[model samples]
Target chain A: TYTASALAFALRNLPVPVILVGSQRSSDRPSSDSVLNMKTSLAIFKEAPFGEVVVCMHGTISDDYVLAHRGVKVRKMHSSRRDAFQSINDAPLARVDFPGMRFKMLNPRFIARGRREDFQVVSKFSDRVVLLKFYPGMECGIIDFLVDRGYRAIVFEGTGLGHIRNACVDSVARATEEGVLTIVTTQTIFGRVNMNVYSTGRRLLKAGAIPGHDILSEVAYVKLSWMLGSYPGLDRKDYVELFHRNIAYEYNPIHKDSLFPVWSHEY
Target chain B: TYTASALAFALRNLPVPVILVGSQRSSDRPSSDSVLNMKTSLAIFKEAPFGEVVVCMHGTISDDYVLAHRGVKVRKMHSSRRDAFQSINDAPLARVDFPGMRFKMLNPRFIARGRREDFQVVSKFSDRVVLLKFYPGMECGIIDFLVDRGYRAIVFEGTGLGHIRNACVDSVARATEEGVLTIVTTQTIFGRVNMNVYSTGRRLLKAGAIPGHDILSEVAYVKLSWMLGSYPGLDRKDYVELFHRNIAYEYNPIHKDSLFPVWSHEY
Candidate 1:
C-alpha cells in the first residue's frame, strides 16, 4: 500500500486507472488469492470510470468481492490474511463483486477518467528523508544523526494525537534550525493527528514540527520525498505550505469512523 | 496509558485495584467530563473486585458508564475525546455503570484480588533504550548512533508484518552483535507482527530482532526498560527469553476483533 501510494504521488495527474494488485497467498497454495485478485483487477480495468491510483484486492475472507482502495488511504493490515490490505481512516473507492461480475462505487470522491495527454510523471524521489517512531525513552541523538547527515526531512510517527517525549523537543528544535523539515503523524493509525491539544504536542509544533493532519505516516514520507525531489529550491515556508495542502487525496477533511469489516461494534 | 502500563509492569502482582483516571476537557468548561469520570472511578474503587492496574475513563460520548481497562493494554487513541483512552488488541477489564451503579466484569481474565502482603515493586528503569520507526528511506546511521552510544535496546515499529528496509538489516545485526537488544513490533497497531511470513521480516528476525508478539510498541519499550533495570546482569539470551514472556499480562494471546465502540461495522 505504501509503495502504491508513493507511485501515485510520483505519477501525478493520472489519466487512466492505475490499479495496484497483489496476492497474499502463493500460486502454489490451493487457497491462493492470485487468480481471483487478477480477474477482479482486470474487471476493474475494463469497467471502472475512475483514473486514480488504487489498490484492488480481496474485500473479505470469503472472496466474494474485491475492494478498490484509494492508494493513499490503504494499508496492509493483517499479516497473512488474504484480505490484508484495507482502506484506513476512509472508505474504499469502489467494490467489484466476483460472482456477479458487477462493479460499484463505494465512495464517490475520486479522480474521474481524464484525457490521455494530460498525464504527467514527477518520478524523482529523495532518499535523505527519515521516519522515526517516538517512544518514552527514545534517545535525542538519533535526531542529531539525521540533522548532521544533512537529511532533507524527518517524519515522526508520534503517539496519541501526535506527541514525542518532552526530553526530545530540543533535538527537534535543533533539526528545524538546521533547515530539516520535521513532520509529525500519529501512530494510532485510525485518527487524525492534532498537535494543538496538549503541552507536549504544542511544544513540538512551536519547535517547527509540521502537524500531519490525517495523513498516514507512510504517505507522509512518500509525499515529503516527492516534494523534496521535485522542488529542491523552495523556501522552508513554501515547503511546509505545500506539505499541508491536499495533494492527490492524501488529506481527509472529515474523519469518518469505520471498522475493519470484521470487528464487532462493542469497543 | 503508556505510563500506566509501565507502572503496572514495574509494580508487579497487585493485591488491590490501582485505578488511574483523567479528563479530556478542563474543569472550567461546561462540557467537562471530569466530574463524571471521577465519580465513576470512585465507584470502581469502592466496590469493584479484580486487583489489577486499570485505567478508568468515560465509555462513550454520554456519561452513562466508565470503562476499567487493563493498564498494560490501553492506549490514548484520540486527541481530546472524553473516551480517548482505549484498550488496544484486547477488551476492557470491566465496566462501571453510572445510572444503575452496577459493576460488570467484561473480561474475566484479570488478576483477582490477592493477599495484600504479596505486592512487590521493581520500579528501576533505564533511559538508554530507543524506539525507531522504519520508513522507506530511513538512514541506517540512527541505529549505529544508539549502538555506539551504549544504548541497551532498540524497539523498531516496523511496517506490515514486522519489516525494516533490506538496507537496514546489517545495522540491526550490528546492534545485536553489540548486545543491544533489538525488537520489532507492528505499525499496523491492530495485528500481531509475524516475522516468519515475508523475506524482509525473516531477514530482520535473522538479524536478531525478537518478534514482539501482539505487544504494542509503547508497552514493548516500557517492558524493555524494566528488564534492563530490574535484572541488570542477565546475558543476551536471558534478556530475549524474559522479553518474550508475558509479564503483567502485556501480551494478548488472542487478538479480539472489537471496534473502537462507535464505528459502524463497514469496511
Candidate 2:
C-alpha cells in the first residue's frame, strides 16, 4: 500500500493511471473468482476514469460487480474469501457492473482523465527502505541493525494507535538523527494514525518519527521508498511536507460509520 | 493475544478458570458499551464453567449478551468497535445473557472444571524469545541480529501461508543449528500455517522453520516463551512435540463457515 502511494505521489503531476489488482483465489481452482475479477478490472481500465493510484477487486462475492478502491484506502479483510478486499474509512471510487459493463461513480472526489501529453513516469525506487512491525519486548538491536546497515528509511507497524516500547525510543531517535526517514503506522489495520493522541505516540513524534496518518504500513514503506528514490536531493522539511500531503488520496478523515459496517443498525 | 494465551497455557493444567475480558468502548462516553460488556463478563467469570482461557466480549451490538471466545482462538477484527473481537476459526465457548445471567453452551469441546486441588501457578516465563513479521526485501541481518543476541526462539509472522523471503532461509538454518526454536505463522491473520503447501514454504521447512499450524503469531510467541521457560531441559524433539500439541486450544481445526460471518452475505 505504501509503495504505490509513494509512486503515485512521485508521479502525481502526470496523467497516467496506476491500478493495483490481485486475485483472492488461485486460477486453477474450480470455484476461483479470478477470471471474472480480472475481466471486470480490465473493463474499468479500458475507460479509466481517474489518473490516480487505485485498487480493483471483487466488490462482492456475487460476481456481478467490482469496486475501484483508492490505493491507500483498501485492505484485505479475509484470508481466502473471494471478496476479501474492502475500502477502509472511504467509499470506493467507482463500482463497475459486470453484466452491463457500466461504471457508476461512488466517490465524487475521484480525479478525471486528462490529456495524454501530461503523462510521465518516474520509476526510481530506492531499495534501502525497511519495514518493521513492533511487538512488546522487541530488542533495540533490530533498530541498530537497520541503522548500521545504511538503510535510508524505516516504517514501523506499531501496536494500537501507533505505539512502540519506550525502550526503543532512543534507537528511533538515533536513526532519525542519522537521517533515516522514520515513519509510524498502526497494526490495528483500521482507523487513522494519530501521533498526537497519546504519550507514546508523542514521544515518537518528538524523536523525529513521522506519523503515517491512515496509510497502511506496507503503503508507508513503499511511499518512503519512492520518496527517497525520486527526491534524493530534497531537504527533510520538504520530504516531510510531501509525506503528510494527500497527493493521491492516501489519507482519509475517518467517518464513524466506517468502523462498524456490519452493525449499522445500532447507529 | 500472546499474553493471554501464555497465561492460559501456563495455567492450563490447573483447575481454575482464566477469562480474558476487555471493553470495546470507554466507560465515560454516553454511547459507551463498556458497562454492559463488563457486567456480562463478570457474570461469566463468576460461574466460570470452562477451566480454560476464554475471551468475553459482546456477541453482537445488542446490549443483552456477550460471547466467551477461547483465548487463543480470538482476534480483534476492527480497529475500534464494541464487537471487534471474534473467534477466528472456531465457535465461542458460550454465550452469556445479561438480564437472566444465564450461560448457554456454544462449543462442546470446552474443557470442564476439575477438582480444585489441581490448581497451580506457573509464573516463570523465558524472556529470550522474539516475534518478527516478514516483509518483501527484508535483509537477512535481522535474523543474524537475533542469533547474535543469544535469543532462544523466534516466531515469524510470515506473508501468505507461513513463507518468508528465500534470502532469510540460511539464517533460519543457522538459528536452528544454534538451538533457537524457529517458528512460522501467517501474517494473513486467519487460516492455518501450512509450510508444506508451497515450494517456498517447503524450503523454509527444510531450513528448520517449525510451522505454527493455526496459531496466531502473537500467541505462538507467548506459547514458545511459556514452553521454553517451563521445559528448559527438554530436547529438540520433545520441544517440537510440545509446540505442535494443542496445549490450551491454540490449534483448533478450522470450519468453513467460520471464515465468512453474516456480514459476508452483504458482500
Candidate 3:
C-alpha cells in the first residue's frame, strides 16, 4: 500500500544493487520510459559496484538521460512519466545515456545479501474476511452483505483513526450477531488507531469494531483469514490469544528499527 | 490517525491513565455494546488516579463488562465484537463491570505516562495519488483511466510481493507517460514486496513501477495526498523528497517489519 515510498522501502536488504527504474513520459507519447529505463539500468549495471540498493531512471531533463539510484534513496515525484523518479533523502548512484546506454557512476554501493533469497510465501492470511473501504458520502448498510454472505471476518478501513459515519450502526450489529469478525483500520496512511483518542473513534469502538492498531486493512484481511484457519475450534478467549500472537512478523513486539527483515534476529 | 495507540503511545508521556473504550456488540443487536461500554468507560474514568494507557472494552461474555487495558500490552482478537479484546504482552490497567458481568480481573495494571506532549500529527501525504485494489482477473486499463483522469500517483495492491498480469503493460506505459507515479504494494497483507524475488514483480519494476516495502496501499494513499497537499509547487523531485521523509509514522523506514500491523508487537 505504499504508493510513493515503495521503491526505497523494498531496497533495504536486496541481494543485488537494487535499482528502481521509472519514466516520466509514456512510450506511447513518443518520449517514453523505454530509453530512460534502459539507459538507467545499463548505467547501474556498468557504473555502480556489482551490488547495492539503487534506483535507475531518467537522470536529466532530456531524452538522452538515465540514472541509477540507491533504492533507500529514491522516490517518485511525477505521478506519471519516464523522468518521475528521483533520489530522496540522498543522491543517485549513477547516470547514463541511451546512446548505447553508457554508464557514469555517481556513487558506490555494496550488497549485504550476496544472492536473492527465495521469496517464500510468508503471508499468513486469515481467511473468509471481507473489507469495507468506507469513503466520504458512502452509503450505509454496505456491510450487511458480508453477514449475508456468512463471512467469518470483516475489516473496515475507516477515515481517520478508524472512524466511520454513524449511519451504519445496524450493519455492524447484524454482522456481530451473525458471528462475523469485524476489525477497524485507519484510512490515513500513517499513525496508529487509539480508540480513546476521539469521541467519534470511541463511538466506532463502542459499536464493536476492534482497533486494528496500525495494521492496514489489506493486512487485516489476510490475518483474519489465517486466524480463522488456525483455530476454528477455539473458544473466544483462545481465539483472542491466537489472534494476538505474532505467529508471523505481522505485529512487531516493539516499535524498533530492528523490526526490518534483513537486520531482524531471525529468518 | 492512531486514536488509541497514539493517545496510548503518547500516554507514555502523560501522568494519567489512557483507556481505550469499546463494546463487544453493537447496541442495535439484542446483545449490544451499550452496557459494556458504559460500564467500562465509567470504570476507567473513575480510576484515572493511576496514570496509564488502558484499553476499555467489554470485559466479559456478558453485556455488563469493561476492562481498562494497557495499550502497549493489549490485543483485539475477534474481528467484529467487543468481547474480543485482551492483554497480549502487558496487563490491563483495571477491570470494571456491572454486577452481572461474567469475569473479573486478577491483577492491577501499570501506568505509562501522564503529560500530553508526546502526541501530535506528523503526516506528510502525496496528495496526487489514489489506490487501485487489485483482484485476480481484474479489468485491464483501469490504470490508464486514472491517468487520463489526471491522477498523478497510484498504488496497485498486487497479489504477492507486488505482482500484476502482463495484460496491462500498455496501460502501465501510458500511466508512466502521463507522469503518473506508480508503485506496487502487496495484497498478501503482511511481508515486504521483493521485485527481484520474482519475474512478475521484476517486470513491473522494469516498467517503472516502484515496489512499496511493507506499507499497505491505504496508508500510502493518505500519505501521498498529505505530502502532495503540503508542497504545492513540488515537482516530481520534490514529490519524491517529501514522500521519502518519514511523517505520520506510516512507513517502516529502515526495514519492513517482515509482517504487518496484525501480529501483535509484544511490548
Which candidate number maximizes TM-score?
1
Candidate ranking under DockQ, highest first, comes to: 1, 2, 3
Task: For model 2 chain A, give the 10-residue run with minimal summed lDDT.
Answer: A258-267
What would the per-residue lDDT of candidate 1 be over residues A103-194, giving only the tens digit for each residue? 88887677788787887888878887877777766667778877888888999988878988899899999998889999999877767887
* Rank order (by lDDT, best first): 1, 2, 3
Interface RMSD score of each model: 4.2, 5.3, 15.7
lDDT per residue as tens, model 2, B1-267: 666777787774556567777776667788777777778777777776788888788877667678888888776665555677777667777788877879777776777786788776776788899988787777788788888898999999887667898888999999999999899988777567778767889998998999987788888888888889888879889999999998778887754544444332121
Model 1's CAPRI class is acceptable
Whole-structure CA lDDT of model 1: 0.81
Per-prediction share of native contacts kept: 0.41, 0.21, 0.00
lDDT of 3 at A14: 43
Question: For all candidates, what are the clash counts?
Answer: 1, 6, 95
TM-score-best of 1 and 3 = 1
Q: Please write out the lDDT profile of model 1 over residues B60-135, one tens digit for every residue.
A: 7678788988998887766556667778778888888887768787886777777778888998888877777776
Report DockQ per prediction, comma-separated: 0.42, 0.33, 0.02
